[model samples]
Target: MSIDRLFPNLTEDNQAELERFGDILKRVWPLKAKHREKLKYDIRDMSRGLTTERSERKIDYLSEARFLSPYLTYFLPWNLYRMSRLFTGLELDIPDGSEVADLGSGPLTTVMALWMSRPHLRERRINFTCMDRAPKSLQAGLKLFNAVAGENSPWRVRTVKANFTDHIKRKADLVIAANAFNELDWSGRVARPQAEKLAQHMAGATTETGRILLIETGVRLTGRIIAEMRTQLMQTGFKPIAPCPHVEECPMPATGQGAPWCHFNFSVKDAPTWLQTLSAEARLEKEGVSMNFLYLSRKGGKDWGAVRIISEPFKFHGGRAQYACSHKGLTLVDHGEKQRPLFPGQSLVPNWPANPKTDLKSGALILPNTKEKR
Candidate 1:
């Protein structure tokens, strides 16, 4: 079926342009794709190839070159929106006039998006230092920054091609590691080791109430990774600021649900030519699911707990009612309570309760969050 038939009065050229839009957005980061398959290998290479101090460093310049692979092209169009939404619930206390250093700022998409989202912050003396060892990734980030913000922007931006191994002496109000931790698989077992180092770097902020958001990718919108993050942060000084509410970890996915039980997917509005054609045949087989794990701890919390992981429900605009839930993960304590806003379609469709309603908080869904799991 032709798009012309679906959307009338649209010229063939307009339809073609629309198709081109979707095509470009579908591309994934090619270099990351290879890294994903052999993440462990990449970590090992980094450890063996570079000096001990440099190899264990927080930021690396190689990530940018890796992102340049053809696979990453698909992420161009909606990458900004996706990342912004991912970090939406993050309520960090980044002080005014704070200079932020985005360590391992791959593609600069998130940094640019952050600036764009908080235009007011740009007005203040907020200097963003994108530190990474990868020249190609940093260059790409700089290009994106320029595209979003023309030659004359109040925000001061700089891209560093050096890794963070005592080479630079600058301290920042806030330090972040965006999507950089996932690269540990690129080298191997070093992912955990590298994350330990990165965690330390974020804690080394120069300003008062130093804050950090160790954003981890969800298995689409599931909460498992979030749990892992909580534990990792506890090992350090970090504590849970908030849960990536979109997909909070639930008990169902791990124990109750069957294989491939839960997943998530998004609509590609301007799908490129191939996708436009393929999407017609591309029935909604399953949704693309992911979860976010966040960790934040101040100077002294007395004692800290291990981070917990949970599986969250998938998120999207409009879909069938059935796709909106999985109660097998809900804890017994909150099992029969009034539905909170977190339940899917709670806002739109009223009186809809989670099926079975037996998910236990003990299982990754809810942890000892004195801060109330948001």
Candidate 2:
């Protein structure tokens, strides 16, 4: 069975709201057709500032209308779609009247994603504090959040103009930072120290039942940073709640040359056609979105003795294979031609052999458990 079968809720009731939000973005965008060319140009510049060119690090999106408009209309909605999909799959155990905080909340992207993706949360009264250094961004985000939340909503939101590591006065039940920390050390040279510092701040901001979710673009350096953060948090009594099966040292190599880091991809085929068109017009057409994320909690959850598929299927001479991480270590799981292929990030407790054979090409131990996984 594939991932959708194991998690039935994944297939149902997700895309409709996302599509509606796309329409909402279209209606709310300030720029008209006459500004289409300029919007595309701004989008290109935003892309360069974000993904490339370390010299453009000081570029501020909220301070300028040209950059902020593209960010709000194109980048924000796309990120919201990705975040909503991610939130849909996780079982975040938030109670009624829980206090939540969003760190480095660029236009409240994570909060909005939780609101849209997890409708069950809507019934519960939530107090949210969103923190960011940019006051204009916070103001704009509040406007957009209210427009989406409408009247008489059970949730209350407040904005704080502060740095990412600034002290949050109140500890929250859930803390979120999405695409936030990567900006601190973009070169990946000091990921360890940066992660350690971030872990300290995050630990101080959350309680015993608190859960912390951090997400970043699925590049190699970001993966290393996330993994390093995971190690730092685990050392401080936090435990992995998702995407990681064991508390043992991370098997995915983060250092050295030509090493493959762990990350997952979500298809954008289900995204609204208008959004896709808009993306193409901006010359940033995306077939799928990829991210590196880690969800950690002080309180432990069920321990699934399983292997998480980390990569898409690659074909060998006799069968197909994919990279997986488990308590044993990084593994290469081989599937017979007749067996169903597994999806990335899907976990299963496989029937293990006493002594697994190693594959020469991938340098990972081969798991021959080609039998149908539950």
Candidate 3:
């Protein structure tokens, strides 16, 4: 089932808002037929900003409604879907009346995803603050938020037109940075201290019992930057909550000798038709959405025994081998046909036999013995 289907009513409501937002964009930025043909090219170029040179990362068209229209139609839905998956998979326990802050919250994507994922919080009097460096983007985000959240909603929405890394001064119960952390200068050649400073700031801004979430493009450099940030935050006493089973040093970094970085894929089969169309027109992959994310908290109480599947299962003659990471370290686990299929980001506790009479079916094994029955 699609992630959005988990909350049918809420998903419908969110879709309605998305349609309304799209309509507003079209009316505000009516494009001529000739200009419409160039949208795909424009989107293609804009998409390259994630890995392009720092000077080329800025999309000046972001301030124009004409460009923003296509972006909203093509990118927003998939991002929302990814955010929904992240929130659902992590299963965060945000309390009632919590103050949530989203850094680099372009067009309010993360906030909208949060609302859609946790519809129960709509009536709980929450405060949502969105900060971005782009004034126009913040304005657009505010409009989207107001359209989705009517005047009667209990959410107190606020938008700040400032760079989140420099202007954020208040603490929040839940802090999120989506598709923004990679913008910080962390290239191998340049050692920008801003990356560590931002991590420290986020760690310090989180309230006790609060959680911090960071999402970035599922690319090699972004994954490495996230791993470095994880190490920095861990040194400051923040423990990883998801995608990592233990608070030890990250084993997979881009600098490692061909070691795979941490990332996950979310199926986008249920994305809106408009997004799918634009994705096809832009010649982008439409089946799966990839992202690298980290969830952390000051408290450390994760189930260390639960191991995370880090790679796809490799099928053999009578069984499969899956690479996984656990508190102990990385291991290749052999699984019989009776064992459940393992996907990336899935966590399972291994049941090892201590005696001859112990039942192995009660819990899955991390690595099955070669002599064991397949």
Candidate 4:
């Protein structure tokens, strides 16, 4: 079977609805079992304070989410939650085929799937790296890449064991941070170290399209996170992209259903098949995985801000996922959609003329609907 056939999407000419169906199926039979439930608990880890004057004390590469997925969000499928970030972050035109790096890449399978599915990026020579401190997780991530993408994947896959807390490594064109940040055990942040490490990489890295992607579970942390995230990324010289919320003293203020907070919930109807596929595909075989997430980001060199629209429908054409999301706060119809500058600090729209042009009044948001024609 052609690789593209396995993963689906929506398009202008043809739309596919079955892919969402497939994603939903996994919710019923999550591959992780109780571990999935455990991620939901907000309390600290039970395995902390294990050090003593005996037997090389070891902490699982986690301060929390031990035996759990970073932050438990049973509402949405974990994979889908990550995918939605692209639209929400206004990173639609991520310089196709550009070099991309995934810091603290966990179990490369999922991210690899993302790379393989994006044909536009495949044509570009991809410089890929996965860094993590845990040998087990790194090893698992390695195996994941090989299994998910056959033997002849094009991207250059490299692994390294280093602390994200310290400065290290050269950056690539684009940097990716999955759920690695929130998993830290340190006070202030479980993931802040990783973010700082990423900044170090940025200092040394040469990026044609300088950009960073940070996606995390968005349940309890939803309201709690909005402002803090904006501040941290700003410290790194980054701004929020469009189709997202302008949280950091955002100047563009208006009255609307506050940029929709994206939440991912597995399709209650599609869980069984997803569970069965996991056994043959990834670890936690024959189980389900779900995550409700909120993604925020500013595209490279853009002053535009963005906040994910929770619960947006995935529309397909023919059978491909062309138009997968519809950002909130903005609309397909611009007949006086009241343009509002994202923030008062905003001088002019950033990256204004790229593939994803922005309308100031409506703020940076998805361009009309991207849904495939049925």
Model 3 alpha-carbon drift over 4 Å, by segment: 1-34, 52-55, 59-67, 189-192, 315-318, 336-340, 352-366, 369-374
Question: What overall lDDT, based on C-alpha atoms, would model 4 receive against the true structure?
Answer: 0.39
Q: Give candidates' CA RMSD values in order.
A: 11.8, 2.2, 5.7, 12.0
Please report, as a residue range, the 10-residue window in candidate 4 with the lowest summed lDDT. Answer: 1-10
TM-score for every candidate vs. truth? Answer: 0.55, 0.93, 0.82, 0.51
TM-score of 4: 0.51
User: lDDT of each prediction vs. the true structure?
Assistant: 0.43, 0.78, 0.68, 0.39
In order, how many clashes per candidate? 67, 0, 0, 53
CA lDDT, candidate 3, residue 24: 53
lDDT tens per residue, model 2, 1-374: 33331111233455666667666665655557778658887787888888877466663556666567878878888887777767777777579989998988988888787887788888889999999877777788788777777777899999998888898888998888898887675455566777788888898899887988888878887788788888899877898887787887888756656777888876777776777988888889998888778889986545666788888888865778889888888888888676666777787677789888887866788887556766
TM-score quality measure for candidate 1: 0.55
Better of 1 and 3 by lDDT: 3
lDDT of 1 by residue, 327-349 (tens): 22332222222222133211121
Candidates sorted by TM-score, best first: 2, 3, 1, 4
Clashing pairs in 3: none
Specify the highest-lDDT model's number. 2
Best-to-worst order by lDDT is: 2, 3, 1, 4
Candidate 3, residue 314: lDDT: 74
How well does model 2 score by local distance difference test?
0.78
Off by over 4 Å in 4: 1-77, 84-97, 166-168, 185-208, 222-226, 242-272, 276-374
Tens-digit lDDT track for model 3 on 1-374?
A: 00111112225655555445555546644678877899888778767654464456554345666557556656776777677766665667667688888888888888777776667777788888888777687777667666666668888878887675665566799888898776666766553365677778887778888888888868887888788878877777888887887876665655665676777765665556666776888998677767888888888646546566666677744878666555655555666766555556766665544532212422323455233322
